[model samples]
Target: MWDSRTPGIPDELFERTEEVPITKEDVRALVISKLRLREGQSAIDVGCGSGSITVELCLQTRGEVHAIDFDQNAIELTKKNLKKFGVSAHVVQGKAQDVLPELPQVDAVVVGGTWGDAGKVIELAVGRLKKGGRIVIDTILIETMYHALAKVSELQLADIDVTQVTIAKARKVTTGTMMLARNPVLLISATKP
Candidate 1:
């Protein structure tokens, strides 16, 4: 189990699957920071792959976390990671569009995958978010950033922020250490008003 209250629980600690992707630890830190969640706040993790973000949210918020994913494997992986972390969350295996409506208002929403419907996901996420609630959309593809940006702008959310994170981890080479770059992630954050 993770001992610290900080975000970025090492990437290896979580149960993972090759088919499902988990947001990296360094990137998770930024996502959690943008959330600005406090204890007792509720959050919805859309496309909760590997449940890394869900675990962080549960640990940080110490509140309710609804983890929704379209893939059953992702849901199972998320549940396993949650169990490993000794954190509990509402793990649901369904499309975001279908599951989001059933949940009550939430303090934050984080979208890790859109499955090609970034706009639709953002719309639903913003709709269920409470006033002053924060939303973070994490996209590895540039196309998603464009769609999310346009949708968030159309909604006229406040405090819109876009960031591109590039992390390079050091690897031990024969003589020295070399930096291995991971894929870049673009984050779009906004607050509901």
Candidate 2:
């Protein structure tokens, strides 16, 4: 449904559920900016969820796309969205720790979930990231963010940056519009050295 070259696709267009999270539009834009993907640069979405980020990566890079998630329902939902958007990605139903090692080196990676194994997940992703490659990890938990930051630094990644994104959108209310803030995320971006 989204045929634009621009990155921010509205969140409502993607098939979503409470169990499977889709990166909100504003956050997706920031993540895409951090990735700095160019045409034909391959990427992997470590936690595909509703495939929102996966579809964006596919459109942005026009390169090989791989998506991994541990939940089967999430996998199915991802496939549906991929089909809906007429984009293709190799959707793998497995944990990042297990799936990331098998994939070929890529230009960028976006990790959305770690299943409480942020340290190992970041390590594996970095292992497969090509030299000069970019990686972005989104986590709401302070502990997870801290763990990811430490892991990326320990791996000696370059151009490391992290932003605590707090976004709010205006909504119609009685006689006026009100701003409602979405949950904050610690967005981490780095490049393999």
Clashes of each: 0, 0
Q: Which residue runs does candidate 2 get wrong by more than 4 Å? A: none
Residue 142 error, candidate 2, Å: 0.4
Candidate 1 residue-wise lDDT, 116-147, digit = tens = 99999899999989999999999999999999
C-alpha lDDT of all candidate models, in order: 0.94, 0.93
Tens-digit lDDT string for candidate 2 (1-193) = 7878889899889988888888998999999989998999999999889899999999999999999999998999999999999989999999999999999999999999999999999999999899999999999999999899899999989999989999999999999999999899899999998
Query: How well does candidate 1 match the true structure, expressed as C-alpha RMSD?
Result: 0.6
